[model samples]
Target: MKKITVFWGCQIPGRLTFLEKSTRLGLAALGYEINDIPEFGCCPEKSLIKNEDEKLWLLTAARNLALAEREGYPLVVACNGCSSTLKTAYVKLKGNPKLLAEVNEKLWEFGLKLGGSLKVYHLIEFLADEVGAGVIKQRVQKPLRGLKIGVHPGCHQNRPSPAASFEDPLNPRKYDILVQALGATTVEYQSKLMCCGNNLTLAGKLDDGWRMARVKIQELTNLRADALTVTCPACFMQFDQKQALYARQGDILNLPVLTYMELLALALGIEAEELNLKEHRVDPSPVLRKAGIINEPLPFNEEVLKRCLTCGACEYDCPSARTGVMSPQGIIKRFLNGEIEELINSSEIWECVECHTCLEYCPQRFGMEKVFTWLKHQAMVRETYPNSLKSGYEMFVKTGRLAKIDDRQRQKLGLPSLSSQEPRQFVEKLL
Candidate 1:
């Protein structure tokens, strides 16, 4: 068994202890020697601190690496952000002598030196590559059969490609492969490679961050995905917290977002209570019931849905509203004014492009998009769509693209080939 120092970065230990718990349970089950050093501080999280002070970022990260080096064990990080920071610091200090000297001078006062022996590994990659998916599959006391999981690798896990060499940066397969070994099917969805938008929130673009999460959630919902699995704490917070926040404002996603470790623990036959499923904002009961992991269903809280009607910010900024065919605000007003039948019958509901702009802009953080989405579903059930809409749907189903891309024309223009195949495949799976 290989011994490694587990760096349970600030987020995990401070807030997401469930992730920490699951990670320990899964890793222990795998028979790895895990060591926890109290001296290890924050990976210092690369985004905010690094931007503010580069030297401080390097110093702090170097200190963490020094602690792991002193232990003579490679650092295994559960958070993608922490892995990126620590790994980047390791690569930088080893390659740049001057910078390493500067950092070592700072560490010398504390009886620590940034050493060349320290290596950082994201826990997901460690499990996939080092532990081997075969060993994991063999250890599965309970396979997650008949479950459809959407994997969110988060941005930092496989980027700054030279530093994080474990997985492909663009099209990662390790997370998907790891989950599949547990007997669950990974669902393909749109923007599967995009960031979870948590960083945007830190940058004060709260709506933009939620928009990133909302789009993915909407696509997953369309795919009828059972649950979403993420390896990063920031991504988990974005999906889990924002999804719950949206649920409170009547935009109910109801998709249980699980950390990869949590999912792994479940496959290892760990009970829901042990994994702290209840701590999650969105209820995991739907996923639990689907997996036959739980018998009793959790009750839905209707009070959370009562708040979205008052906030019309989503409608005010809606592009569809500018067309005068009934805005999100107007639809909500009509519903509140006892015109539910008229609102459902109106073709304006279908005009929503599902851009999720409304969801993003709402002050309450949940918008009229859910209301319009429900109406659109009702229209589909009633077969009340216009001829143009029917034609567009038929075209997409037939050709797998909203509009054809002429590969010959691109070739003639000396341009690179358009990457439409992957998206087309996603569309096929989604449809």
Candidate 2:
């Protein structure tokens, strides 16, 4: 049996335990053996990297990869951030012989040499490549049955990829292939390729964060998506669990968000509870219940902590706020407001489209979407009608679409018209 090292980062253990389960089981079901890298610890993450200690970051990553190299197996990471960091460190070292020597010199302390021979892959890439989508397609006991699904791959995964693999970082389809194997249809939304607004949480720009998710959610809802699926835990937090946070201030948009594994597990005949669907802050139970997968709604948790330092790094990178709706100043006002809950529940927070601009900029590693997610949960509890989000909610309910603009809107806006049959499709066409 072939075996690989599982790099379980910090977030997977504390925040996304089921991801570990789904990846472990999903791969096991496919006959690939996996083992935990016991010597491994935190990837030090983006937060620690900011301390300006490039050498430490490089050495640590090299050490982890070397562990896999020593065992003569490839290194596999479940977290998008970790995958990006580990892969980037390897690339940085391999590309620069001098830096490689320095890092390797440090590695000599641990009885390791960094020649960068280890292969690091994100879970999605490994599944589509190693497990073989055809095999997954054949094992679909409970296919998604053409259920509408939206995908948001995190930014870090592909930002550094000069040569694309698995899927385009800007427009990922690896998850879509798995979704299709489960008999689901993927949504073609404007921000479908956008980053989740997680990074913005570190910055003080909550509004910018909200708009990123809002834009994507609004698009997906307009596309009539049944649910949103994401690979990264942070992406999962922004798009799926934060709906309630954005709903409180104004209109509420209801969309069930699930991990790629949870969906795969459901298709593989695993129970919802076992996959931790109930733990999602956005309350996916109603959506799953509506699909007849569950009889009753599961409990929804809204855990709001203290205010983030409000760095506004989220606004710095948000594409929507950069283009429309919430401006930089507005982001600060919401995050700096006296009534934190009211600020979070406000309609301004509902405008995000889930693009990951904020996550890309935040120096603090705060989750910019928390305010919005908390608000969405509050609105759900109060049974309040979401005013800012009505149009999107109605769109999904009406057309099974997630975009307000159709081919006609494209034409009116002077955007190239998509052909009914072949206007031009890229990601899906590639698949």
The per-candidate count of clashes, in order, stands at 0, 64
Model 2 is weakest, by summed lDDT over 10 consecutive residues, at: 297-306
Off by over 4 Å in 1: 296-431
lDDT of each residue in 279-300, candidate 2, tens digit only: 6767777555433355332122
Model number with the top TM-score: 1
> Which has the greatest lDDT?
1
Query: For residue 310, what is the lDDT in candidate 1?
Result: 54
Model 1: what TM-score? 0.68
* Residue 188 alpha-carbon offset, candidate 1, angstroms: 1.7
Listed in order, each prediction's TM-score against the native is 0.68, 0.65
Q: Model 1 over residues 336-414: C-alpha lDDT tens digits?
A: 6656545655777777878888767766666667777766654443345577877877678656767778889999999
